[model samples]
Target: MFVEWMMGLAPGWVTAIPGLSRAAQLKALGNGVVSQQAAGAVRLLLERAHRT
Candidate 1:
């Protein structure tokens, strides 16, 4: 799913793990960071800071 990609995780990182329940998988994904999105947010903040 796109959420996995957002987390910068490889395919199957969430869904393919043996013994993981669906709810657990969802919780893990929910707790993950969207690395690229975070980077962009930080960059935007830095740019605005520099402009001030």
Candidate 2:
């Protein structure tokens, strides 16, 4: 439950994966972040800061 929240995954999303344990799912999610999405968020923040 905590892992799903931390990873921003929808409910039951983790259980859909086959053959992976909960621990492994949590580990992978912890280490995973979409680089493009992160970059976009940073850019948006910077732009907003500049405007303020």
Candidate 3:
């Protein structure tokens, strides 16, 4: 359930591999970042850059 929620929070479309091993799936999920958080960070950086 948690994984599904996290995936849903991603901004773009996410694809699931059908035959991935458990370890691979866990690794992918672990490496994934929240899209909304990343976008916010980028927006803040751009705003700061614009002020300079």
Best by TM-score: 3
Give the Cα lDDT of each candidate.
Answer: 0.87, 0.76, 0.68
* Cα-based TM-score, every candidate: 0.61, 0.50, 0.69
By TM-score, highest first, what's the ranking? Answer: 3, 1, 2
Report the number of the highest-lDDT candidate.
1
What is candidate 2's local distance difference test score? 0.76
| Residue-level lDDT tens digits of model 2 in 1-52 | 6766665668667656889898888777777785567989999999999998
Residue pairs with colliding backbones in model 1 are none
What's the C-alpha lDDT at position 15 in model 1? 84
Q: Candidate 3 — worst ten consecutive residues by lDDT sum?
A: 8-17
For candidate 1, the TM-score is 0.61
Candidate 1 lDDT? 0.87
Candidate 1 structure quality by residue, lDDT tens digits, 1-52:
6668778889888989899998898898998777788899999999999999
Whichever of 1 and 3 has more lDDT, that candidate is 1
| Span of 10 residues, lowest total lDDT, candidate 2 | 6-15
Choose 1 or 2, whichever is better by TM-score.
Answer: 1
After superposing all C-alphas onto the true structure, candidate 1 shows an RMSD in angstroms of: 2.5
- Quote the lDDT for 32 in model 2: 76
